[model samples]
Target: MAKPKSGAKKATPVGKTGAKPAAKKDKSSRLDLIKNASKRVATTTTKVVKAAGDAPAKGSKSAAKKAAPEAEQPKEKVSEKTAEKASTKKSAAKAAPAAKTATAKTAPAAKAATGAKASSGKSGSKAAAAPAVPAVEKPRPRATKLPPPGEPLTKREMEQLLTAGEGRGVMGEGSLKGRLVVLNEMPNLVVVGRDKRELTFLLQGPDQEVLPAYVNHKVSVSGMIRKTTNHGGVVDVRKYSAKKPEAEVVEAPPADTEPRLRYLSPGEVSMVTAAGMGAGIKGFAAVRGNLEMTGEEFVLVVSNGGTRQQVSFIIDGKAAAKGLRKNVGHTLQVMGVVDKTSGWGGRISAENVEPRPSEARAVSRDEMELVHIEGEVPTSVDVKLNHGLTVRLPEQPGFTWAIEPTVAKRVGLREANFEPGPNGGPATREFFFTPRNPGTFEVEFFLAKALAPGLVDRSFKINVTVKP
Candidate 1:
């Protein structure tokens, strides 16, 4: 015990000052630990209170307290570090609910904003989204009226209606009315406008049968107007109304005579042209007239005695003798077959010809020299050379007859003398000549207006022969 080692515990002295000071130091430390623990527990409690205020229903507060009781019992042996860790965990859990609540509240605003943008797209575009509107229509103007019926269209009117181009509708399309003349019966029906400038038509449809009853008579015809190469109108008839003739001629002929072999009138020939010739007609086709050579055919010009209705017959061959060209004015009877095959209307294929019987009498040369043939004449005649020849001219009404003086001088014949028939009737003329030689001579006879001074007339050329 002399001197205790420095590292060993030493005994305390029983002094009042030393003991009081030691005890006081110990108390101060205790109080300081209590204060620190109290501060930590207060901080934890503040966090728990705030979490409950923010999200009381998110989790159970009792469970949080049971799991960590560091704040409830500050006297426990738990470490400061442990208490701090538990408080941190509680704060984290509480903060998680707060963050979720904030996120849930903000999500609806974001969704609402997105919906607004989508709705604007559907209704905002103008041209692409709008409905369509309908358009209104305009009306047209009417057309002008056509010309009156039965009236001949003027040159200007015709020019306006017709065209030089081919086809039926060249004369624009329309209806027309005019006088009808049926040119033929059944099978092929043809008609024409007698007063409407003789506009020809080709009759068709159910109304065609009614047209034959109106032949050579006046009637009103209605149909569609068309054109042809003949410059005549063609109608597709729909209806017709006939005006009865003033007089009707009914002729009953001998029985059993064939149609072709019977004599045909001028009107019949015209009908044949309109209807067309079926097969062939054979019989004597006789005509009395002066002969004329036209192209490769001979034309016989005739005038019916009573009516003076003129007609022409086309012959196929030449009928000229060596000196007969000068006798072309002399009348002769030509007999042959009349058929439609050769020429326009009808043709006479002459088989033989001779002077008319009344003019065929032979005269003695002495009597011919003494006779002064004048005033009127026999219808036709023949003569001998070195003797005078007398010709008889017929009465031709509604006509002024004449002969060329130059022709008489050229043929060595005396000038002709004319004698008119009684009471505004026909007129006649005679031709006489002393033949100096044997030959044929031709003469031209013409018809002209009574007072007209010009060559506006139709002529007949005849051939005469002087026998030796």
Candidate 2:
């Protein structure tokens, strides 16, 4: 036969020289294959050995003998290419478990890692992976960022803005611009800027776990304001101080005609806070409330605001500036008997006023909207100013002692008069009147009873009737 082609099978070698190339090549390759297979198997065997204290795998020796008997089989049948492919398939099938095992090993190691090295590793991994998500949104804005208090406002500015009343300090948050301090250790820090327009701020620090603490005195604080789901935003406090000194007054039990009065009796200042809550001193919403005294003087300061106002009452028939603190901010409950006084600022008087129990304070976003009534209110007097007829007006119940004339001649009015009402006290005057004509007209009655800075400055209208 012709010499076999180079690409074809080699001829059987009979001599030792040729034996080196064919026999040695086959044996070495066989050994290499066994070595490679042993290595691959070692991966699994190593795990078993480590777990069981390095003992030989059960039946491994028997399996080795069985594999040796298969060596005589044509090695070409189990070619390297075929073995490699099988190994690759086996590896692919065990991929998940192999990775999991690696991770299992790493878990304990990862937990044991210490120092910034470990932390940095975790953070770096998180940072890299987290950035992969491209759709995370940003938070919305509430108000303009404000400089944290103490960081900005000087002590002098704070003192100048919030000092004792009576021209001593700028009018309560109305006049000047100063730092808004959300005080701690007061009754409640819900003190709104008192007005809508205020400084911009956002609550900066608050793990937001606990609320700030407040006690019975009016405290001052400075902080960063933040908007909260709460009607108003919460304040992040920085510095605070309680500012309730004391007052002059005596406390006695309530009188006979008064409502259920506690903590307050006669000759004491009744802190009228609400509009119509008729009750005792405890009626104070008790937010930042305290019963303090100063040498024969008793005072009840409110965290919401100072109770009892001072109004100028017609005491002793003299225009004296008196401090009147009664029935302010109340709707339903009328204050105590009006008493005149002297040595007070502006027009003021004292009355037995209590905390308003009925009126609920407006929260942050509540409708503080006011509905202005257009229709005129009926007063005790109905004046007709027409045909040049001026009549003396009749008196009313509370305003019997008329201080001004109530007669005039105008378009639809003919005449009017004023008379006294029931139980006119020494300081109060009451009156009632009649109109001679028929027409719509406006009137004013200075009840000589004013709790606010402005006296009984209410509006009244009269619909006069023409004589039939």
Candidate 3:
């Protein structure tokens, strides 16, 4: 370093003292140039940010233009190529935010696809990788329509009705038109539905009275039916009407053909007893009655409107036994001949035995005998054949009256009427029966006490003789 002279212009080193005024002025100008350039950049960056904020979530081209805002180049000027490069860098930066926003907008759709698989019990990674499609369901089978009412049921149709269950339109609901063939006139009406097939049925309600008049005649029957075992069932007849004769002959066989054996009425069979057994009685008799089986013996106790009688029969070996077991509560037709010593009583040889359709009505009070029974019972009581036997029982508390099962089986439960007593102790019970056969029966009456549980109170025995 050299020492400077005083009062003379010192040759000061450039770094030793402060810079020159002209040099300072040039520096200030350079600084002002830089400041202006920075201000322009800041203003352009603010404009770009404002444009991006105002744009939709899916952004617009305006945002991109604002991102590379051409900062008015400093008045000092710059190369065109360099300005283009700077603009490109700013454009890339702004495009990056738009791409991020687009990705964010599509995030819900991607998450929905992933969630579908995840709900289907798949792992998160697998759910995110693949998706599933929904499935469709199958339809059900259709139903079948019923056969025409006027036509007869074929073998297949009959079998279908026989084996039909709920929902099978086999014995389809609604009215059925057919020829009514009455088989028996007894405690209940029994008849055959003679359409394409002979369907046996028990007549019920007011229709029972209506059918007896039109036996062996063509008619239209309306009712509800519930299927039973075998090919037969019972009809709950609601209404019935007589069909025209032309309708009956529509499917009728040849006129010269031998007709089916006609069943006899209850009154006709009872008239047989007055005529007695003889050579002329060898003809077929269609008698209606209750069929009872005791060991090897088969007996029928027939009932007339005014009387009842017993008729024994020999079973035909050639007869079909398809529905024989279900005929206990049914009225049956015994087509046979009358003889003296065929069974325990007067016997009739049964050529054909089957369930018969009939119109059953209750016995009138005029044909009944009222007998009051109390503490003591007589040794024997006389009951006229076919006449109603009404036994009046006294009302007592905690006591019930019943006949023995065997006696009830031989006779019948018939009808029991219960009426309220004067002081409401219990009830006055009236039991009725019409003796069919001429025999001495030991009827056991049981007085059951409520306190004894299973034990019976007092048992009274009585001998009843049905007159010939």
Instruction: Give candidates' CA RMSD values in order.
Output: 23.9, 20.9, 21.4
TM-score for each candidate, following the candidate numbering: 0.21, 0.24, 0.25
Candidate 1 per-residue C-alpha lDDT over 218-287 given as tens digits, one digit per residue, 9 for 90 to 100: 6655545556544455555555666765676888766988554676556444433332232244345565
- lDDT at 115 for candidate 2? 27
lDDT, candidate 2, 1-468, per-residue tens:
788667887756586355566656755665565455434444543333233332233333343344333432323333444465543444333433543454356333323332234456668889988876567666543333434343343445334333222112221111122333333222234342322323322233332222223233444545653333223334454445555536747877567666553433332333233322222222211121222221122223232121122222221112111221232223222233332222221111223433445334322213322112222345333233322222233322222111223323233221121112235322211122233356664444333222232344343444334332
| Tens-digit per-residue lDDT, 1-468, candidate 3 | 766656778666878767677566854554454455556655655554445445543343445443443643432242333244443444334434444454344344334433453445446557678767577654322112222344344565554554423213344344555556655451122333322334554545444555667765566665554346344555556667775455334567788996554444454345553322221233456666665433233445453111112233434434424345445435678666544342123566666887876446466657466444554465677877777666666535644455654576565446544344444244555667777788888877666542122357776677778887
Deviating ranges (above 4 Å) for candidate 2? 1-203, 206-220, 223-389, 393-468
Q: TM-score-based ranking, best first?
A: 3, 2, 1
Off by over 4 Å in 3: 1-18, 53-62, 65-287, 290-468
The candidate, 1 or 2, that scores higher on lDDT is 1
Local distance difference test values of all predictions, in order: 0.48, 0.33, 0.50
Ranking by lDDT: 3, 1, 2
By lDDT, is 2 or 3 better?
A: 3
Stronger candidate by lDDT (1 vs 3)? 3
